[model samples]
Target: MGLKSWFSKLFAKRVVQKMYDDAAMAVQHQEQILSYLVDKGVKTEFGRDHHFHAIKSHTDFTQKIPVRDYEGLRNYFDRVVKGETSVLWPGQPVYLSKTSGTTSGAKYIPITKESIPEHISAARNALLSYINNTGNAAFVDGKMIFLQGSPVLDNSKAIPTGRLSGIVAHHVPGYLQKNRMPSFEVNCIEDWETKVDAIVEETLKEDMRLISGIPAWVQMYFEKLIEKTGKKTVAEIFPNFSLLVYGGVNFEPYAARFRELIGKEMPTVELFPASEGFFAFQDRQDDTGLLLNTNAGMYYEFVPQEELDKPHPKTLSLSEVELNVNYALVISSNAGLWRYNIGDLVKFTSLSPFKIRVTGRIKHYTSAFGEHVIAEEVEGALSETLKKDVAAVTEFTLAPQITPESGLPYHEWFIEFNREPKDWNVFIENLDTALQNKNPYYRDLIEGKVLSPLKITLVEKDGFQEFMKKRGKLGGQNKIPRLANDRKIADELKAWSVKTIASSNF
Candidate 1:
């Protein structure tokens, strides 16, 4: 590494040390933090702002701010999405991280200079943490590949976004070799496409070491790389490859399938990330859950699932949150969000209060046909019903699709599994039974109110998400709806996943 790059790494390490040793305790406490924010109210800079206290009263602080849905933030976000300057701070937004809203069409969230730096440290920590925790410098002698969205925009302008990813790429402390391939996408800027194409094309021509990004997309690239080079395995192609880094979603369901392709227990790191903030990350492949990125930025809050929809339900500041119960996440951050709902549901894995295991999205649900099918309920039912049949949820996208034969709607579960049962019929029946038992709505659906039954789709172990990523329909904050709850959303899922999954008789 160059001298400048080496010192950047050295400096970054010191910063990381300060974060863990100095700021750790303060960040962990939520009550004392309220005092801190109150004290620093309006005085705290953009990076230091709790944001909640910026416009709120001291009385509102303790009363537990009411959680907002789409309607709540519409006016505010609409101003930004309409291309107004100062929507974030002053100037027009530089990049819009396009993503599907929970109950609406895709959204374009804005970011500005002041709020953009929060991700730099996260990007830097990603590198430092890997070295400190894993004690490996595989990149010191090899190339690093980051597979991501359309690197180029439609106008040919560089998408000055990624919120965190852009900062990571442009500000990496001691980046070894920045090698990659053209973003695998269509209909945008020619130059941007060219740049992405250059990266992808060249990566195909050589070896890659530390690799990261949406696992589904990366796997797709590897598939193409194989087709181009006629190589059988990634190890044979990128001999220097050491560790695989993935996040944006759960890796368990795809674990068996990915292992078969990447070749068994290939060291990995599962990351937890969202546009609102980076909560935590996995430091080791074998670790059950990711180490909370409590050090990254912002303070956190959690309210019970039952309380999420309650008017002014009780909210727990970091210190007040309890363990094991599923809670809706709330954030107090530099981004000016105070008690903002990020739409994720999580359960704490420990008493320390710094760790959590993401269960699923709060809105990814179905109650139409009397079955209130939610991510948690479906996850629970699938696990219980398939207890001995299979062990992993690896990856799943549940939706209501029309069956050609039955000429009726049904709840479809697209499953990618390593082993298939000899009697798949009983397994499917039991899965349906489990869902009906967990939620009363499902029973009604079975009784003919819902108009559908359980349909199982066997996928090519590692498919699905790749199809979405190729279409710029994948990311950390994105949710794959469980019910195809509405028309546009349902049609979109049917477009990408339907074509890839195997046909079902049900």
Candidate 2:
């Protein structure tokens, strides 16, 4: 190994050791973080309003601060945006992470100086932990690319504002600057297609080893690379490329397509990161669960999934959580978010050191006919079916077809296949059976004849891409929702549907 790789290995060993030590005392660390955040919050305007000074325990916290989404916290956020000091945190945020909002048009999440390191270090440690585990640090010596949003910032806000990935780009450690690919000028291109074309040109000849991004956009990049060079696979273009670092979306649905594009299965590191906080990272290759960052300057709470819609849902600290039960993740961070519901639903895979797998989003589900099917169930069903079939899918979404012309109403799956399944009937049957097994409610609905078995609509190649592009959400952290409660997205998908298979499938 070269000097850089050797140093990386040495450093990774120390960091991994520290992480192990921290994980061992996860509860203590979380309690300390809660105390620290409360102490600091006591001086802020929100703290005073929420009676933070009186919160002595987790129960007290639950009583004092109600779980809220962005809309609930907007009053304080508005004050912060207007240049008010200490409206939320102790002082003004270093940056505002702008994200797409549901009810609100745009969300500006504060990234305080104290909390920024959590985002940066969690990502770095994820890679370092990989190196430490596998004793492979050579990837550190080669070029790394993170296909993300443009790093350009909008200074018009009280604080600098940009997409979370763009904000993160400005903080890439100086040591990796030389190893990072696609020069700043290329990254700054406003249009995603133009930016991707520029990236393909810049990194084509480099010794790329680590490529990171959301799976959908990265697939686009891979396709572009293949189209540009007439190469059969990504591994053929950059032989040294080995590690894939990804977050923002589950990788299972795209796993088959990615394996085909790369021509081989390589190591991957999954991250659980969002504008709210960097919550977890995959610490062990053998394990699918992401180790929650207990020592990070954030406190976590999980509300039982079934109780989420209630007026006063019961909240549990990390210590109180049990295995395999879905919970809506709530957090209080150094960035001034208090008891904020991040909307993600996660299930604890291991409780010894608190490892979790994101199951779905609280709002992103299909429940049109009283069969509550989540993202995890749908992804799991598809993933299981793919394992048994010879097929590759590019993208897909599930929505309830409440009003099909003639047959019993059922779930509609809009799928864009990279390679069509050899037997469509078997694939659909297996997929439907898998989903039924995962969700008992769905099974009941199917068995009772209340809903028909799910039907597939083969979307034309690049159909989802065209849909996202037309909606102006083509790239950079934007993704298609796996399951929707209504037919809005499903109806919109019809324009891109393959008309040939439309009648035949139904």
Best TM-score among the predictions, by candidate number = 2
lDDT tens digits by residue: candidate 1, 1-506: 54533554565567657655633574444445445544433442321322544435434664544456445656656665565544333445456555566566655445444445656555556566666665565454566666554343333333344433543344344344243322334212233334334555767655577777765556555556666677777777777788787776555445655655665467777677666667776544445555555543365677888887677777776655677788888875545445568888887765442667777787777654545577767767776665546534345667666444545677777765546655666677777878888777678767864465677766554445554455555543333454444444444444434332222434
lDDT of 2 by residue, 10-29 (tens): 99999999998999999999
Could you tell me the TM-score of candidate 2? 0.98
- TM per prediction: 0.74, 0.98
Off by over 4 Å in 2: 500-506
Query: What is the Å distance of residue 215 in model 2 from its true position?
Result: 0.5
Best by lDDT: 2
In candidate 2, residue 332 scores what lDDT?
93
Candidate 1 all-Cα RMSD: 6.0
lDDT of each: 0.57, 0.92
